[model samples]
Target: MNKVLISADHVITGPADRVITRGAVLVEGGSITAVGTAAELDTSVEPEVPRLACPGATLLPGLIDCHVHLAFDAGPDPLRAVAEADPGELATAMADRAEQMLAAGVTTVRDLGDRDALTVTLRDAIAAGTATGPRVLAATAPLTSHGGHCGFLGGEVTTDDEIRARIARNAEQGADLIKVMASGGALTPGGPRMWQPQFTRDQLRLIVDEAARYGLGVAAHAHGTDTIEHCVTAGVRTLEHCSWRTAEGIVYDPPTARRIVENDIAVCRCVSGDWRLFLEQMGPERAEAMAGVIRDMRKEGVRFIAGTDAGVPGARFGDYVGMLEFFSSLDFSHAEILDMATVHAAHALGLTDTGTIAPGMRADLIVVDGNPLESLDSLRAIRHVLTAGRPIGM
Candidate 1:
């Protein structure tokens, strides 16, 4: 069971976009040991070794979604749904959502926010084999100001003491990273406006420093222009949304953006599968403007990793490839887009083991029916998925 040979019509061994026709990957002890042509690898393996042959399919490193919320259901009133659900019932549903994403070829997902710090329990369950799901990097409870966005999740902090205490508790609970609500959010009704900063500049800096002490990075949720600028100054590891919103409209700041590139800060737009409706929510003109700014910032060397913000009103657990398809409209190559979901995303999340199909990397990979290099739509044709060398059922 420790040795597996996965052969496919095409294998994408990446950090770069290299494709090998009739390729095979050898995985042993949950890590990739060899990758080459099917013929080359087949002859080298013993006849007793298990071989999973996938004809007319493309194999690539498993996809990663940089942001999602497992607490809410993708319904008109996910907040209400969360409030009403039984705690035990909610935990079961959240585990189901994580597995749903795994079936769609997403092998890893960063859970940014959830009620009751439930995501941390889910993460441990998956790792301990009591549950089946993607490798979840959970932010147990996102730090927020009193009456700020997503405060109901119990991460409210008005003083520096409160902030430090929250981080300490989350770290003790085995949180993979720290999430901070740097700005407001639309989903939280009684919270700050979507463009308002939730924490003072110094407070935000303190959060980042405190997280670093625990060997964790901070993912700041910022949508406002000023708030995005502040996150940059605070030296967060990643910026969620980075929407650059203002009362005037979505604004782009070149100076702050330049620093983002120079400092190697990653940006997660959290663009979900509901692209059309999401754009509609922003209005056509504003949507176009946001798209334009994303394009401009890409040119300016800003790195955007993939995230669906799943569990929102229209975002689904299995719709991660749809998010990648949206990026095609943004003028990125299929290879570049795939990298965003794989290598770029893993790096952004500080994950080193699962992003590439190479020696010493985890055997987290997927086989789709068609070549994704030709059309990203082929990504949806998931035929098989491997999470650390073990085949997972769809």
Candidate 2:
């Protein structure tokens, strides 16, 4: 069946810089067959599956969130919350959050960490149509150095053999990608300083090599300078929270920044607007140091992507506008910020089929009530959203 959707106003086609005003998008099966002005198409004789007319909205490819933790609750103490919650309770909460994200116009999300592989199960349920939510890329477990950041998910590795075993286990469970905690983190109580390296170069090399053997990409949670160096050396495909700070002060690595640009390894900022609160708690000096490093990295031509680390503290699913606003503060254009959330993020997560609105693309799209081109705030007024040609209603 062929269906035509006449969008409200403009249709932003994504990184390709294509737009159709007073646009209409035609879908056949699960793929888009045409995109043009409504007046350009003669749809009278077609099968006419249905039309979702949004007279005041702009349609674009589904938004992609490259980082999230389905297992963690956005509580004052998320790590403690995860430990206290039972598996059943966590599953129910995660499912609810997924639906909230879809309702808010996020059609795809990459779950970077979860306890007990719940995300994998949730992904299957969404695909089977048993759940109402966004498409998911599940990282069964995030590999961590023994007692390193987020080590509670049972992915602490002390040796190369342990690393290999973990990757094998995730691949066997049908993981979309292998996530490695390469550095210390601020959220882990009494964890190593955020700038400290969690894994040795050889250790990282082993993880990357093993994951490559299974055709799985590695998403490393790295905040420290030394750890980011190890990640680049190990040839990691994606880096999360590349904050680049040391105990002493700002420690931006120019060579590592250049390598990231040259290698095209995607970097997820995962910086939520709530970072201000965390900064205040940690003190102004440390925040300033880290901000300096981030600014320098951006200036060094790093390939940055958007991720709110939602589910942690103040970051929540469907609150991605906070991320875009943060990027805007960093001097990224509105178009660049949207690209980081859409095409760049999709490419980072290996979802090439659903990032853009174009011919032969998967019909995963969202409509907003205003022009996102004019301002990022337009995303908040989502009129409708569709995943694979299936309309989803709140």
Which model scores highest in lDDT?
A: 1
lDDT agreement with native, every candidate? 0.91, 0.83
Q: Please, what are the lDDT tens digits per residue for candidate 1 over residues 1-394? A: 5898889999999854788999999989778999999999999988888899999899999999999999989898887898899999999999999889999999999999887679989988888878988999999889998988888788999999999999999999888999999999988889999899999899999999999999999999999999999999999999998989987888889999999999899999888788977888778888889898899889999998999999988998899988988889888999989989999999999998988889899989999998999988899899999888768973
Against the hidden reference, what TM-scores do the models get? Answer: 0.97, 0.95
lDDT of 2 by residue, 263-325 (tens): 989999887657666668868777767667767877887777888888888887778787788
Q: After superposition, how far is residue 34 of candidate 1 from its true place, in Å?
A: 0.7
Off by over 4 Å in 1: none
Model 2, which residues run further than 4 Å from truth?
42-49, 279-289
TM-score of 2: 0.95
Per-residue lDDT of 262 in model 2: 92
Clashing pairs in 2: 8-54, 8-55
